[model samples]
Structures are given as structure tokens and as C-alpha cells.
Target: MRIATTAEDHRIAVLAALAIAIHVLETALPSPIPGIKPGLANVITVLVLLQFGWHTAAWVTALRILAGSLVIGSFLSPTFLLSAAGAGLSLAMLGLAWRLRLGLTAIGLSIVAALSHMLGQFLLAWWLFIPHPALFKLLPVLLTFAMIFGVLSGTIAAMIHRRLTIGTHQT
Candidate 1:
């Protein structure tokens, strides 16, 4: 039992490392819009959700958010707050998807998570930062980008999952 728990911890650490790397890399990229990010890290998050479970995914995401923010010098800043909100919303959405368990594959859950994350961040900005009705105007743009990036990230996750599963089966 101890060995199994250790293995699980190791798995979570590895997943968190991958997610943190991706998150940091994405943070370095120049966004076309203030809130528009490719969210490539979400690929790993969704993969974790599908392969392990929501708890593992949550661990990976939380680590990524914390470590990524620390590395980028945004710890405890507004940037960190937004990142936390997005990740929290993403995990919540994934949790709901897992509970529903209605034959929704990783791709579907990825889309749902992505949309929820974006909505959460946008809402946070409107409520805490801007507090203006004009902030709501960005909804369409944010949702559109979220949908596109979600599909792309989901496709990437599916491919990685396919390759990993194939390799395991072959071994």
C-alpha cells in the first residue's frame, strides 16, 4: 500500500512538472489580447484528468499555477489571482464532467473546462478589477478564442493519449 501511494505521488509530481513547464512557456508568449492565451498547459491537465482522475488533475493544475506564478515573478499578484481563478474554474468544470460521466471523452471535457476557465477569468476581471458593464462586452471574443484553443488543445491531448496508450500496450 505504501508503494502504491508513493507511485501515485510520483505520478502526480511528474504530471505537475509537465504542466508547470507548459504554463511557464505559455506565460512567456505574447498574447494578441490581454486575456487571450493559447492555454497549452490545459492539454496536460486534461490528459491527467483522463488518465488518472480529477484529483490528480487538480493536483497537477494547482502545482502548475503556484510554481508557474512563482517562476514568472507574479506570485500573489493580480496575475496570480487571475491564473488561480482560471485554474480553479477549470478544475471545477472537470470535476463536474467526471461526476456526470455521460460518455464524455477528454475532448468534450477539455472544451467544457476551457470555456469555464475563460468565463471565470473574464468574470473576475469584470467584478474585481474593472467593475464596469463594458467589461462584459469581451464575452464573445473570449468565448470564441476559448472554443478554438480548447479544440486544439483537446486534439493534442487525444494524440498524446493515443501514443502513450499504444506504447503501453505494445510494451
Candidate 2:
């Protein structure tokens, strides 16, 4: 493991900012599948996890969710709660995957993380917003897309990380 220096911290901050910007863009985009998103932001989270550590990645995830909510004016709503839950669960999964040395490809890790995130969000919604169990029926469809998009985003992130590492010494 590498100790993060001032330079690394600055780099992480820039990455986080880019992640947040991507989150905002995703939030603004219209999706044919309701509540389904490309989750482009996770690309940064995975990069953060790989480059820094799960702790820093967790912080980034939380900050992204909180700041994103405020920026979108959904801070006080149920949506915010859902987002927070999803972020927390996904961070936990990402950390566990790292610690266990899952050896999963980036796409696999992203799929696992995204699935956990969606499960967390849907569970929260079912518990707090929906009065019936039928709400869960919609999850399969949502999860399918989440898996696909997660892989796509993760692959893109992995590629970017690879490209960024070229000719650059690792910290």
C-alpha cells in the first residue's frame, strides 16, 4: 500500500470533482428506465479505491451523494435517503471486494457494487415509501440495466486509469 501525499490528495480531489460532475450529468439525463442510471460516477469511485484506499473512496462516495443531493435540491427528500443508503452499501461492497482480493475484473467489481447499491436503494424505498411487497418486483428489471451499465462504466474507468498510468510513476 502507498501512503497518500499532498500530490495524491490533490489528484484524488480532482477525481472526486470529476466524479461529482458526472453524477450531476447522469442525474440530469432522462432515462427510459425509471430510477435506472448509467452510474458513470462509480468509475471514479473504483479508481479512488484502487489508487488511494477504500476509506478515501468511501469518503468520496459520501461526499458525492451529499453534495449531489444538495446541488439537485433533493437533500431533504426520500430520494436523498435512498441515495445515501445506496452509496454506503456500494462503498462497503467495494471495500470488501478489495480486501478479499476478489481478483474480479473491473467490470465484475462494478457489477457487484452496482447490484448492492440498487438493492440497498430498493430496500430502503420499500421500507419507507411503499406499503406493499410488490415494489420489489420492479427490481429485476432495474438490476439488469444496472449490471450492464455498471460493466460499461467500469470498463471505461479501467481504460482511463490504464491510460493515465502510462509514463506516470506510481505514487
Candidate 3:
């Protein structure tokens, strides 16, 4: 028996591949703190959310996390758990933002997603791995990085989105 696939599936696969490549490359970079990377892969997620709506964005993100984890050999590890938590929360936040019709642009949504992703990971780490009050002390610093990277990725996403939108119209 064969299964059928839609163009949407191909689109998701391509986007997920791009995101996974970015995710893997990011793992190679050095971070000042353990989990303080720029999360540049999420630039793709934000772009997907802006262009394709929440469902497609969710598919792309879920595939990215699962496949990225597998490729990075972090599947079912603590790192994977943290990533899953962060991504799940981030996607949920984006869904809510979309449903609310908040009229937020890519930058606004990216900032929101980044902050929520950090919070989710921090909370999971505190509750599951560390379970220490001292962990809360790092929240502010982590959130600061999240904010900075959020803007950076958001700006990149916005530029790409604009370019794609313009290209679509030109043809």
C-alpha cells in the first residue's frame, strides 16, 4: 500500500529540513550559558506562522524539533525535553496570538514566542531537572537573552517574509 501526500506535506518537509539544518548548525556554536543560543532556526518558525497560519506552522515546528533532536542525537534526553517544552509553549502562544487577532507583526509575535519558549524551558528545568529556587535567579538573564535573540530572529524573519511577499506579487 502507498500513502498519499499533498503539496502542503512537501512544503512542510522542505521548511522542516531547513529548520533542522539551522538547528544542527546552531548546536555547533558556543553559548555563554548552556541554553543561551540565538535560536536562529526559529526564524523559520516565525516566518511559517506569518505566512501559513497556525496549523501549518505547528506542523513545521513539530517536525523540526523531532527531526532536529534525532539528527542531533538528543532525542528523549534532557535537552530534548527542554526543547519540546519550549517549542510546545512557543507554538501554543503563537496559536493564541493568532486566534486573538492581536494584529501583531512578525517582530511582535517573535518576541512573544521567544519569551514564552524561554519561560517554558526554565520552568521545566526547575521542576524536573534542578528543582532549586536558585534556578529562578537565572530567569532574568535567560529572558534577557530571549528578548535579544527574539528581536534578532524576528527582524530576519520579517525581512524574508517581505522579500517573499514581494516576489510572489512580482510573478
Candidate 2's displacement at residue 142, Å, is 1.2
User: Which regions of candidate 1 deviate over 4 angstroms?
Assistant: 1-5
Model 1, residue 157: what's the lDDT? 91
Weakest 10 consecutive residues, lDDT, candidate 1?
1-10
Q: Of 1 and 3, which scores higher on TM-score?
A: 3
Model 2 lDDT per residue over 31-115, tens place: 8876888888988887777777788888788878888888888997988999888888888888888899988766777887788
Q: For candidate 3, which ten residues in a row score worst on lDDT?
A: 31-40
Error of 3 at 47 (Å): 0.7
| Position 156, candidate 2: lDDT | 85
| lDDT agreement with native, every candidate | 0.88, 0.83, 0.93
> After superposition on all CA atoms, what RMSD does each candidate show versus the true structure?
2.5, 4.2, 0.7
Task: Give TM-scores for every candidate, taking all chains together and pairing residue i with residue i.
Answer: 0.94, 0.89, 0.98
Candidate 2: give the clashing pairs: none
Candidate 3: clashing pairs of residues: none
Predicted model with the maximum lDDT = 3
Instruction: TM-score winner between 1 and 2, please give it.
Output: 1
